[model samples]
Target chain A: MGKGHPTAARAFVDNRERAHWHDTALWFVREKRDRQAGSLPEWELLRETASSIKRHAQSQLADYLLQFEHEATANGAVVHWANTTSELNEIVTELLQSVDATDVVKSKSMLTEECHLNEHLAEEGIDVVDTDLGERIVQMRNERPSHIVLPAIHTKKEEVGELFHEQLGTEKGATDPQYLTEAARQHLREKFLNADAAITGVNFAIAETGGIVVCTNEGNADIGVSLPKMHIACMGLEKLIPKLSDLSVFTRLLARSATGQSITTYTSHFHKPRRGGELHIVILNNGRTELRAEPEIRDALHCIRCGACMNTCPVYRRSGGHSYNTTVPGPIGSVLNPSMDPKEHNSLPFACSLCGSCSDVCPVQIPLHHQLLTIRHSVKEAGGLAGSKRLSMRLASMVFKRPWLYKLTAGLGKCAVRLTPRFIKYSRLNVWGKGRELPPTPRGSFRKWYDKNGGSGGR
Target chain B: MTRMEVAVVGRTTSRDLILNKIRAVELPDVSHPLVDGVLTGAIEYADTVGTFVGSAESVGARVHFCDTDSVVDIWHDICEEFGSGKTANVGIRGLNDDDLTDDSPHSASELVVYGTSGILGVAENAAIWVSDRAINHRVSLCLTQHLVLQIDAKSIVNNMHDAYAKLQDVRDDYGVFISGPSKTADIEQSLVIGAHGARTLDIIVVEG
Candidate 1:
């Protein structure tokens, strides 16, 4: 079993310097998002319209998928469907094998990460190199990407330089990002030119135009897909939109909310195969339909994987994405992971401070905090709550239910806490006291202080 | 078979099961909103061409504002600075598919400059539209060392909404909106100008 969020976060925040900068860096991105979102006077309307569009799409998803498949097939492209992650992986492997592809290049794809596609492909003896710089760094280190958008957000530049020195043979201690990126560019360029196939993630799949849009800032997807003879695009089944014109709304909000840019560097649309090349899109369900059945939290499906929620999440910014221990970490992950496995990720919903910043910045206007709250109840009802948390809640309920018990404990609990030794008070049993010190016992209960000042109790 | 028996034995292909699950999902049936090209807070560009140049320059593209007559001179000067080597021209007359080997998008030349190549210019974001229909070799837009786009000033639109509106009739099998030269801030959030695509994007906005 994996450690809970608090335990992992303790290790993350242990390095005070890194934690501080991590917080500052994410906050900087959050501020940038604000500036971009603020630039649009119709931002709220856009969010509402996007939310409406997503809901409409969710309602008629099956029809849109059928429409998309029909149009795509007519456009001379092949469409594959997968009900599970393993099935998706097998389909991609078979496609690559059909072409006798030995070397493959892929751009940033959270779905592939969720399915561990690279690991699966590697077992098949097919080498798939991640082309995104951050993704490549984490790939080299044999680690899961902490954040969906910024895969190497947790790694320092010096560490990247060291990795490059060992792998690509750069200057021993050079820490400049510019110098390091240039090296990766030169290296990945060779990989792109030599790669037999290219795989990318679909940003938005238009049903009307039979096109799948792949947005990128580095232009990696375009170069790789264009150079290779075979291009396979993988996407979650929820990425479909009703019309081609619906793209403008998302494209407007996506880049602004993601990296504060007006738009990505490349928004390449693939409607058909390149000349004689093969275009195959693998649409993976992977429990998306199950997630859709959850009416209370169904709004969570509107996520475009922008990472804006992560950038604005106080807990995520401080504790880091690694603490979430999920493929797509932060607010959306907390809500989505519990739906997949309640027992494993029950602690995730409680990780948030309930600041509602995620909901505020969400381009699609998903009520994230509300969904997290609902998921928390669902987790407890599913018998996924930790015994320690259950015990604390039971004790609190016991005291609050009875006036005598509440008054008695209120008076004695402070003295007990004050008199107790630090070690005893902060024992392993006190899960609440793990990373934080209980605030100095409030001078006195507010009830007692109010009575002393001017109270009916005196009468 | 009875309905219950049929339902019990209905677990078939994954696609069927997946689509059935989606069909069972109960969500509020919302409608797609009608979108017009004119949107709120749309930037009013006093001069669309001038704004295009500024937006393009800000995003790391070298911009040249010239008339159709000066286009030749501008192309010549930029080409001289950008290696003065083999180039794959798309729409303009210089060197095209006839001159180069139409074999692969990855030309053997170290310096491949593509010119007279853009379909339109988007002023709001500086994204120029180009497609497989015109470019023939789409990879050269990114894989090449440099990209030189020659866009008519009248074709520049104010924002993405307008850009898409103009593209209603111009849909190709594969098209791209090249906003700027390749860039990435993925490595520790430090912005790098060139990643996998062209290092430089020079635009020749041919106006009156």
Candidate 2:
């Protein structure tokens, strides 16, 4: 088996400066989230309430979804459901074709990324321009988003400047963010005006009013949907909530957790299409239904995609998002991806240090670290590890079970470490010794020391 | 056969399959958490208008306070600040003032759109609620160079929970809680004022 995360992370960390920059940058966001969450006196209570609401919604998803469809259809929207990613892509392509749309502008939707909708549409000769500034940057450079909320976190300003200089024809060597943003604004402005259809991802879909909320700092979702005659919104089935009031709970926590902002600049709630316009809502259940059946991983469905877990993950911070090699990355992705395809993504669960920072920062209070631990057991049960590794684990477990054997091995290990030469200790067999040193071995076992200091209950 | 016709064929069957899968989920029922008392105590401002102005300014928005009757004069002042001449593309809607009567809602590249906000403003976040009825076109709020909103100072609330309570029943096709101008920190974590929306947002609070 290929070494998955460690090998990929080594590639990312090869450039020490860039790796350090990425770590510090994400830590800054994590700090900002801490400040925002700290400022709220009822932040913990809010998280509890949000988690409960999501649990209740998921348990009764069928009822809520049907109610939403009824209300939305009554509100003059056409709601479609897809059982797979290809089905969702086909639905979106059909919607665009029905409108005879050639040019489509899309806001940043991780659901679309998951479905690979842009590539699917491109095959049929449809041009979908991503409108979010960061998405647009990465789209032009032909790279996937490294960070979910901040799609281009892996990209440096000079690299962005070079990309814009080539794609948008801005002045060469113009690395100022304000200057680059203005060029994107001018270029995307034209695309927005002439686009025939707009596609967006739903942040929250309210069951009571049949409305979908799309939050953005750049207002790209609002601009794309408002200008076009047809608005197509795609959402995972988990985005549904029972009532409109639950939105207040999520809306308050989402932007604060994502970017340390009190609120996004625009939180647009689209109840229906504009007068004389078409609104198509596509709900996709690609492997999420099976995920909900797994009781151990069902809580992960509560994710609102705020991306706080990613920013707070130490391994993710150093390794970067691309190293996970999944549509969603970080601690949550590690758990969710393996559950979907264990053999293919078995190494993802091993990517964590089990620090539990992701669980603490999660807005919905998903026990992410515990979920990763569970997935690790499942991976082992499936025999996803290499033969040598499995044998090593079995030997270790055998030694751990027998006290005398363990004691003998521990004593021998101490002697072996003390007598080993530096070259042997730091050899290729010892992966941990590459950037670290072996600590000096203790002369005696802790049990022996405890016996000598005080017998049984003397202390 | 056209692509549209082919797509229309499988819509019903796909819907059935998805709903069936959802119905098959047999997990135990989970009750929604009781949030009745969780949001009761919020940070209150002694001076709501003052707090609103400070909060709005902190989020990169310019705030102006004027008496209800001086809204027109304040609009003129804002226009002057934005360097508006007689031939400027200033579009105003939903503000029932004869002096502020520009009716066309066409959003241009460099147009300035003026409108009134729906009831309710959160003091903690300086967010103003605007529904579809408050403006002719929602695109005008986003597709303009600058957005000038006229809000009533008396409608400010303490926090998001209270704001939701006030707007829970009103049914509009579209609405938004705009906190400030459009912004992005996507490039090297640098904050840029305008990414693809209104570059500047001017809030004219009308004192009751």
Candidate number of the best TM-score: 2
iRMS (Å) per candidate: 2.0, 1.8
lDDT of each: 0.85, 0.86
Model 2 lDDT per residue over B67-95, tens place? 86777777767767767632122223223
Model 1 per-residue lDDT tens digits across residues A1-459: 567888889888898899999999888888999998887777898888889889988888999999999999999899888888988888898889989999999999999999999999999999999999999999999998988888999999999999999999999999999999999999998999899999999999988777899999988999888887899999999899887777778888998999998889999999987766999998998888888988877888889999999999989998999898899899999999988877778889999989899999999999999999898888788877889888888999999999899999988999998899998999888877867888888877777777889767563
The TM-score, computed over Cα atoms with residue i paired to residue i, of candidate 2 is 0.94
Cα deviation in Å at residue A424, candidate 1? 3.1
Which lDDT tens digits does candidate 1 get at residues B1-208? Answer: 9854453343237778899898876677787665543345555577888788888988999887787667777777877887766765666534355244476766633546767568788887798988878666677778777778888888898877777777876669889899888999987788899888888889887777
RMSD to the hidden true structure, all candidates: 4.0, 2.8
DockQ of 2: 0.67
Candidate 1 achieves a global lDDT of: 0.85
lDDT of 1 at B205: 79
DockQ score of each predicted structure, in the order shown? 0.59, 0.67
